[model samples]
Target chain A: MIVEVRGLKKVYGSKTGVTAVDGIDLNVADGAIYGLLGPNGAGKTTTISICTTRVLPTAGQVRIAGVDVVAEAPHARQYIGVVPQYNTLDRACTISENIFFHCLFFGFSRPAAKARTAELLEQFHLTERAEAYPAQLSGGLAQRVQIARAISHRPRVLFLDEPSAGLDPQSRIAMWDAVKGLRHQGITVVMTTHYMEEADELCDRVAIIDHGKILVEDTPAALKQSVGAQKVYELHLRDQPGRPELCARLSRIEGVSKAEQTGDGVRVLAHGADGLLSDVVSAASPFGLKDMTITEASLETVFIQLTGRDLRE
Target chain B: MYARAFAGLFLRDLYVLRRELFPFAIRVCMNPLLFLFVFTYVLPHMSGGAAMNPTAKMAGSGGGFGTVLLPGLMAVAIMFSGIAAVALPLAQEFGITREIDDRVMCPLPVWAVAAEKIVFSAMQSVIAACIVFPLAYYIPSVPVQAHVNSWPFLIVVLLLASLVAGALGLTIGTAVKPQQIGLIFGVVVVPITFLGCVYYPWAALKPIPWLQFGVLVNPIVYMSEGLRAGLTPSAHMPDWLILAMLCFFLVFLGWRGIKGFYRRVLG
Candidate 1:
């Protein structure tokens, strides 16, 4: 494992302390992309903070490349790069200077630092804004520069905290591509985000965390499979008087595992799609079913099924 | 390896300082220049003495007030520049934005960050003292002849004074919060300047023995008196006492400042 966390716990405040993380164990393989998926204040950031040595764990053993993080933080720091949730680029210096200085902090020679800075800027498509101060860059560009700085020293493990939190779709795609490129370079990546689609697209393995604990950890495909369904059937009902009554009746049908009223229709999850579709239609016939469509189960559906709450909430 | 990291951090600060060198020079010179113009030039000339002997009537047993005020102004320059060097940057670094994570997460140990701030502030303090010295020596209305009797002693005193100022800056920078920065100036900096014996010699405060004893606790007092002993030997504090107190403050403040820095960064 490139990263290992065992029995991790964190508590804030003294008199009425809040447990931010509670006994979470995680193992990330070398060169794998790991995602931590959770809602706001769900201990995702706290887990990454402890792993990166930014926050001391209350009770845990975290090892990066087999080195204990707490006991040998300075040594462990050399192998890890962290792109924080906030913009931590040095505003006083230009983008290139920011990256160059970070390289120097890792004891790179001046010529070597300059070369690495150039390579990172080029890779991130930030070479054009190399001389620009942080204040002059747009949010997307600033985030790129921050990532560039973090990786300037070429750390073995890169930890990104919400790397695409406030980005447009295009910028978020570009960020994902950049992260994928890092995985190709044999760098292990650990990231946290509330975007379920992002985790599905980028992560090889993901852990859904909430209330300071990991609710589930598996591949996105396996997680979706664990929802006990291969496909979801949506039944759009006409605004009839008995629509709610129809929904309750459809939920109790044989082979139909769960059924709930969505904004525009009733969504039904079932293990076998062989007879479930006809079953849903027959149950909804008297209520004046308008349309019915079947689609593959997704990570979003799996997350909602596991947590019993919307991922955004 | 640690040395290289330290140099990188220090040089980064130096680059920023270099970019703002002009404005920094103006800030360092403004107060000392104003104080010198009024206390050594305007007041003495308006009191009716001739150009060379303008302040003879106001002269005490040692010399005119200009002689006494010169070293104090230099001390003020060093203290202000030193404190500003660390305090302003630290306030921004530890503020709500907390833009210091890059440096904090560097491979170097945490204490090196605090040490770098002190070293950089001390360097700026030395520079400020040098700038204030000539202004104090030549700007007075009356001829102020500061006899430098011992160059070695003068060098030692100035070096110790700079370290003391740097140590104090570290303490103030780490202790004060961003919103309460203005309060530091009002409650800490202003009072330290006024009670630091900046306008008079330490011995001249003998008549007010209570105030004299009280002001001794101020680190700036020792700095001012040390400069007095170097620049105007006739009116100064005891050499041993000045050196001893500054040395004690250097150790005490450096220890406390590093501890505070660790708490703020780690927490």
Candidate 2:
């Protein structure tokens, strides 16, 4: 494993009594893009903070590249790069200076630091902005510079906390590509994000956490399957008297797992094959259903099923 | 191990400081210029017939008063530089921006990190003193006669004073948060400047017995006292006493400041 966290426990205060992360176990293999998917306040930041040695863990063992973090945190940090959710670069310095400082912190000599900074800036497409201070950069540009700084030293593992949280669609895609490129260099990437699609598209394995506990952990495909084979179908039709009762009755029929009227439409939750399509079509024939569409079991659905709350909330 | 960490921190701070070098120089120049004009020229010319004592008058008369103010002004300059270069920036770095996270992550023990900050800040303090030195030579009645008698003493005193300020800056930097830093200036720094013997000798504050006792706690007073003793032959304080007090304050503040720094950074 490139990273290992076992029985990590962090309790805020005795009287207050909040366990941010309670006995959590994690194992991430090398070169894997592992996502710790969760909503806000799900201990994602705390977990990453502990791994980065930003906050001392109340109790646990964390190892990066087989080196004990607690025993030798500074050396352990050499193998791990952390891209915090917040911008931690010096706002007073230029983009190139920021990268240069980061390299110096890791013991790089001046010329070597300058050379490597140039390479990373070019790679991140931030070479033109080398002389610009962080305050002069756009949100997406600042985040890219942050990534370039984090990776300038070329650590073995990277911890990114909501790396693209507030980014626009195009910037988010660019961030994802940058992350994917890290994997090609055999760098293990661990990230936390609320964007379900981001987790679905990038993560090889995701650990879904809620209320400081891992609700589920598996590949995105396995997680959706574990939730159920049932794909939800929604039928937008004119509301009629006794519509909910009729939908409930239809749900009790063979081939349909559950059905309920939500808003002006009847939503049918079904399993098995598309053969059930005929049964649903016949069942809704009398209701004059229109604009029918099928939706798969999204990570959001699995999260809601497991935790009973929207990821945003 | 410490050497490696020290070099890294020194070089890193130096590199960033170069970008702000112009502003930093301007800031260092501005404060001392204000003090020099107000005290040596404005205050003296405004007040009749030497409310300033003869030692001060003579020191002020032959274009030598500026020399007397030089060391004290340099002390103040060094103090401000320590606070500006290390304490204020460190408060911010540890606070919202939290860029110190990167330094704390360096492959060294936490104490070494804190030491690097003090060492780097001390280096800046020395640079500030050097810049202020030439400006101080222009102030009237600084006892140019004393300069040759005391150049070596002056150099040593300035170095010791800078170290004391650097250590104290570490304490302040770790003790306060970024938002409260302005309050530190209002409450802590203002008193240190006025009572810190920047304008008068420690013995001069003695006649107002209560005031002297009150200002005794200000470490800047000892630094200025040491500088005055070194730069002025007829300075009120004894040379040995000034040296002794400087030694004491350097050790006392250094021990406490370094301890707090380690705990804050390490924890």
Candidate 3:
């Protein structure tokens, strides 16, 4: 394994403490793109922080490329690079200087640092903005600079924390391409994200975590299969929800695995609703709703089923 | 391996400062210039000839008390600029943005990160001190005579003082959080500025025993006295002991700073 985390535990305080990560075991193969999919505040950041030597773990050991993280953090850090959830670039420095700083930190000479910075900037399509400060760049450009900085050191393992959190569609796609290129170069990658499409498109395997525990871990295809990739019905209601008790009653009806009230309507995940459309309407008749539409199963449903709640919640 | 890593980080910081030299020079020199205007020119006219009474023995030509105080004030300015230039930025990088994370990943040990910061800050201190030399010559009223004999002592003391000030900065930077950085200036910097003998000598504070005792513990007191001893012939403190004490404080504070920095960054 390129990365191994066994019995990892981190408790915040002695009294009234909370376990950010509860004895979780994780493995990432060499050159694999592994996704740590979780909702907000689900211990994903804590896990990445420990792996990257940013935060200490209360218990457990992390080995990167066979080097112990706690025992030899600097040496282990040599084999790994991390992109934090927040952009940590020096906004006062230009784009090229930002990347060069990372290279220099890894003990690269000036000439070597310059060459490596140029290569990464070109790859990230940020060559033109080399002279611009981070504050002068767009949100997408700043994210790319962060990515470029992380890879400038050319570590064997890369950890990305929500690399596409606030990006638009075009920028998100561009980021995906850059990450895929890393895997092609035989670099092992570990990332955490809530974008289901992002995880589905990029990751070879994913582990879903909730409330400091892993709910399930599997390949994206297997996870979709486990959740019974069936059609989902989304109802657009006429008025706001009046009763939760009535909604729960409708959810328990035949052919429906779950029913929950959304902002303006109810979402029903049906198991066998090929011709059961009218039945769903009759079930929801008491709620005085209308404008229903059906769609295919997605990773959103898979996430909801594994955790027994929506990813956003 | 450690030497190469340290050099790399050192050069990188220096390079960034070089590119922004114009604005950096203006910002650093501005503080000392304002002090010169208020103390050398405005305060003398405000106090009229009251300043002449205190320094009548050394009052020669137009220069009097203002001339005597110029070198001491320049030394204090050097110390302040050193801490402000590197320490504030270092603290911010470590706390908020975590830009230090990249540097910590170097093959060198974690303590080298703090050492590299001190080295750069000391260099900046040297530049700040040199700039003060020319300005002190121009500030009339305090017409400081350029005794060529004081060059060696001035250079050595300035280097040691920068080390002490930069190390003190590192400790303060690591001890506080990002939000409380402003509080550091208000609580620590302000007190050091007033009690450090910047405006007067330790001998002048002899009249107030309680204030004298309090100022005795301030490192800036030693720094200011040492600078005055080098620049001014009739300075109050024993020059040799002042130099030795400044060296001791630099080594002690630097050792403590490196220990604390590693514990915080690597732990």
Best by TM-score: 1
Which stretch of 10 consecutive residues in model 2 chain A shows the poorest summed lDDT? A237-246
| Angstrom error at residue B33, model 1 | 1.1
Candidate 2 CAPRI-style tier: acceptable
| TM-score-based ranking | 1, 2, 3
TM-scores of the models, in the given order?
0.92, 0.88, 0.87
Candidate 3 residue spans exceeding 4 A from truth? A14-16, A233-295, B41-63, B91-98, B142-155, B177-180, B183-186, B239-244, B251-267
lDDT of 3 by residue, B1-267 (tens): 567778878877888789889887887678778777776767767877345435423423554565556666666766776568656887788777777776776766677778888888888877877787677668746455544357788778888888888888877777777678888888998889778877776677767899977887778888777776776654457778778878887887788888777766653
lDDT of 1 at B193: 96
Q: Which scores greater on DockQ, model 1 or model 2? A: 1
Q: Model 1 compared with the native: what TM-score?
A: 0.92
Candidate DockQ values, in order, are: 0.69, 0.47, 0.48
lDDT (Cα, tens digit) per residue for candidate 3, span A181-263: 99877889999998788888999999988777878889988887776637677776665655465568667777777777777
How does chain B score by TM in each prediction?
0.93, 0.87, 0.90
Question: What would the per-residue lDDT of candidate 1 be over residues B1-267, giving only the tens digit for each residue?
Answer: 788889989988899899999999999999999988887788768877444333332334546667777788888988897788987778878886577788888777888888888888888988999998889888887666587878987888888888878878888888988889878988999999999988777777778899999998999999988888887745578889998998998899889888888878774
Q: Which stretches of candidate 1 lie over 4 Å from their true place?
A: A230-248, A251-255, A260-267, A271-296, B50-62
Candidate number with greatest lDDT: 1
